[model samples]
Target: GAGVSQTPSNKVTEKGKYVELRCDPISGHTALYWYRQSLGQGPEFLIYFQGTGAADDSGLPNDRFFAVRPEGSVSTLKIQRTERGDSAVYLCASSPEAGGPLFEQYFGPGTRLTVT
Candidate 1:
């Protein structure tokens, strides 16, 4: 079974451009998370969706970064203005609801975004 998947393994764009990253989590998983990692640093949590709504969005840097899980399975991460400082690998992970033995999450291969 597919664990978690992301399209466009790499993306390149000019500064000020907009980009949307997609993540398709494993079927039946109810908890999904998004993260961003700059070079030489750990991944920073972005946003999390427990079902059809965002559970914790405090990790989003600003209004420019947003995510949606309208159907409770697939999710999309939207960036308003792409900047060189935003260049990094965007990651997605999925797992069962918290407080369960299956709370361990599985991460997808990150999508590397580059703003030229």
Candidate 2:
């Protein structure tokens, strides 16, 4: 079975532009997560989706950030307005079930976004 995979491994864009980062979760995994990692820090939770709806999106930094998991297997993270501050490594993870002490999340190679 294929693991979680993120597209465009690296992205470079100008400030104020829009960008979409994509993620494909492992087959049969019902839960997916999006995270952002800045320099010198750990991955910061951005959003979590269970099934076709977002279960937790409290971690989204601002109105400019949005994500959707329309069919529950693929997710897209959309940034309305890119900023230098947004330059970071965007990570995607998936698990067999929603978050809990029992299930473990499998992470994908992050998509590095650089706003120039």
Candidate 3:
């Protein structure tokens, strides 16, 4: 895909199961982001990565959520000991280096997670 892509568009799991959601960003985009959206809400930022390191992770709810972008291309969002409130759509976005209009991100279709 020429734009960002998210795998496993929908996920259903028990309340305490662990899950990993993946995102593939546009080639050559050096900045990537993760966001989560619950029912009837806008996407909320989760993390931002520049190159292979996390530049900002304050959006993560707690230690139960983590993300990594080892090669500056693909990123994985990991959730541990999930609860029913964890159910939401996980979104991935990317942009070029943060300068001028390139700082704006392009978002991918989200991955829907459902915890039962």
On lDDT, the candidate that comes out on top is: 2
Using Cα atoms with residue i matched to residue i, what is each candidate's TM-score against the true structure?
Answer: 0.95, 0.97, 0.95
lDDT of all predictions: 0.91, 0.94, 0.93
Candidate 2 residue lDDT tens string, 25-108: 999999999999999999999999999999899999999999999887899999987999999999999999765858899999
Q: Give the TM-score of candidate 3.
A: 0.95
Comparing 1 with 2 on TM-score, the higher-scoring candidate is 2
In model 3, state the lDDT of residue 4: 91
User: By descending lDDT, how would the candidates be arranged?
Assistant: 2, 3, 1
lDDT by residue (tens digit), candidate 3, 21-83: 999998999899999999999999999998999999999999999999988889999999999
Choose the strongest candidate by TM-score. 2
Clashing pairs in 2: none
What value does the lDDT take at residue 42 in candidate 1? 99
Worst 10 residues of 2 by lDDT: 95-104
lDDT of 1 by residue, 1-116 (tens): 88899977899989998999999998999999999999999999999898998989999999889899989999999998887989999999999776566488889998999999
